[model samples]
Target: MNTDVDRVVAHLDPGPGPGMTEGAHALMREIITAEPAPAPRPARRRRPVLRLALPGVALATAAFVALSWLLPTGPGFGPGPAAALDIREENGYYVVEVKDLYAGPDRYQEQLRGVGLDVTLRLTPSTPSMVGSIFPTSPTDHRYLDEIKTIDQPGACEKMGGCPIGVKVPVGFQGPAEITLGREAAPGEEYANVTSFDALGEPMHCVAFRGRTVAEVRELLAQRGLAVHEFRDTNPYIDEEAASRTSVPDSWYVNGGYLRAPGKANLNVSEQPEESDAGGLRNCAAPQGS
Candidate 1:
């Protein structure tokens, strides 16, 4: 990572940072699979004094498992001061939520539809260069979102603690990030809360709260019975690195050029790309806080 940074800095003459760029941390890895320690040696022990306790403990374990299942189907999709937003479920599918930022709503709507999600848009009143956002393009889609934002943004929504459509700039946005709505929301259909959509978009951070929800956007893990992890307190998964605005390379640091001599070598064992991945040319996924 430092080597990459150095290359960028050399390309740009004036350093973007006084040197804090070097102070930046590495991105967290996809997941934390701590290296397993050696198996513990079995210690000699007498059998339990009472056999009756075995059945009771088993029953308790079963009940604990059952109760966990009855919990909400989605991840922690409620209001938070989370550094990152997450919508996860044990079964599959999730929602990503963010607040306060500029965007081309229409453009983003089309983009999602192109990826095949039956979109539920909630547009804001802000107008772009008059060209409109492009995430989705269906008229039905536009109509759907227009109605939702119009309704949710004005009136107070139940449980979410304010209007159904919360933005980063909105006040009183500290409650359920996602309030279950209708029958769909009954089992799990819900949205998440907002504090800021900034840090969630760091590069290498798979769970980001950028233009879309990361949890809902992933393909089925299909590992049935697996528990979903939505929140962790600072156990940095390092491969998931994010560059900061202060980290952005200055003209004196970042440089670009056409590929050299370009003699491509191909033996043909190309790996399949992820379908739901957010591959794009844009500013940092999340900008640093103001």
Candidate 2:
């Protein structure tokens, strides 16, 4: 093998010659090398207009919100202060619906003021005819409880055929006074109501009339031509459960004895014990409404 190596190397031929000649290859290289590369472009600058526009848009939105809060809205804005209880002013008085039993004296007056009046309303159990009616009895004398009087609209109201609770006062009347209304009793509850008051806001008559017995009280009221509607003997122990369900004290029924006269709220009178021999009414005062 050593003896033939030099001879084999010298006899070997190279592969086929390159397709392009040396001169042509050199010319192509010169042409490519002669051209210069273009310069890199600077990064584009962001526009200041977008930055300025954002703050202006934000300011405009804020101004619109402020105006919305500052300006008063139209009638579509929910309701007025007394709308919760459907209270509104009609004619010269405030008209209120006896929807809730516990709307107390203060609450009633407050709602009345919403319609530019200052008055208190006492609620009472009413007969069918007396419901939704307002009486203008003297603020000084309360004897009108037995009589059925209305502020000029009973006939008109009957003709209109709608039950509406109304209050009446003198022209330009501005004073603290109490009014009465009749509310029907619920299924199991006794009817409750308020007594009429004078313009001075004084209670016309004594509400709780002390009596020896319900019979005695009945006779006394009957003698005065008062119509008795319902008689209830309340047990204080039984009322504790009911008292807890309501916000105010039970004005409809007393723990002892109860009586009702037409055009009046339910009355609470004292009854003689089962074994007592006490008899007759001395200076009995009729029970009043809250």
Best by lDDT: 2
Tell me the TM-score of model 1.
0.16
lDDT (C-alpha, whole model) for all candidates? 0.18, 0.29
lDDT, residue 202, model 1: 15
TM-score of each model, paired residue for residue: 0.16, 0.30
RMSD of every prediction = 25.6, 46.4
Per-residue alpha-carbon lDDT of candidate 1 for residues 1-290, written as tens digits (9 for 90 to 100): 01111011100001111111111101111111211111111123211110000000000122232111011113444424421222223334333332212223354344323333344333221101100111111232111121112112223211111212221111221221211111000122111111111111111122222222223211111121122222111113322222111111111111111100011100101022223323412224443221
Alpha carbon deviation, residue 195, candidate 1 (Å): 26
Steric overlap count per candidate: 42, 19
RMSD of 1: 25.6
- Range of the 10 consecutive residues with the lowest summed lDDT in candidate 1: 50-59
Kindly list the per-residue Cα lDDT of model 2 for residues 62-96, writing each as its tens digit.
22321110111112223355432345344443334
